[model samples]
Target: MNKFVDYFKIGPVFTYFIRVFRKPDPNAPTSQNLRMMHGINRISIVMFLFCLIVMIVRACTR
Candidate 1:
């Protein structure tokens, strides 16, 4: 969707790494970045789970 593309400009994998160590910036003018930061973090969690499942399946089959 165009909305998704507009908001999440960063690719899923890169966003995952960036989200890992981000602390909230309280001094910022608005909470828009805060919301996006949380979104990236959520995306990272999902990606991590998907990768873990794939790794587990590959290990099982080998």
Candidate 2:
């Protein structure tokens, strides 16, 4: 939806993270880069949270 797109439309935090972790096309504009970078960040964040939960459960059991 338009609202969702507008919400995550390349803010300062996204820009910095993309600059460091994602090799976005320099020629491409921010809007195009935003969608791609958002996907990449979502996947990485999910994986990080999943791993953190697993570690915590493991430590508690041991």
Candidate 3:
């Protein structure tokens, strides 16, 4: 459990997930923003799904 939490870097990962689920703040710096750029939401969604799948697999294997 500690290893998995460390692997995900929980703080930042949770922040990013929350930002992606909520509307992005317009005043935030462009570089730090989580909103999709160039119509690439699909890519972000896929990556998120992949991460979830990896976590699920690790849990099951353990």
> TM-scores of the models, in the given order?
0.51, 0.50, 0.38
Please list the C-alpha lDDT of all candidates, in the order they appear.
0.76, 0.76, 0.68
> What would you estimate as the lDDT of candidate 3?
0.68
lDDT of 2 by residue, 1-62 (tens): 99999987778765665565656577877686778777787788779879999999999999
For 1-62, candidate 3 gives per-residue lDDT tens digits of 98987896768866655555665467866562333462366477778789999999999999
- Model 1, 16: alpha-carbon shift in Å? 15
RMSD of each: 6.9, 9.8, 7.3
Once superposed on the true structure, which residue ranges of model 2 sit more than 4 Å away at CA?
A: 1-30
- State each candidate's clash count: 0, 0, 0
- Model 1, 2-62: lDDT tens digits are 9978797768768657655676566856577768877877787779889999999999999
Q: What is candidate 2's CA lDDT for residue 51? A: 100
lDDT of 2: 0.76
* Candidates in descending TM-score order: 1, 2, 3
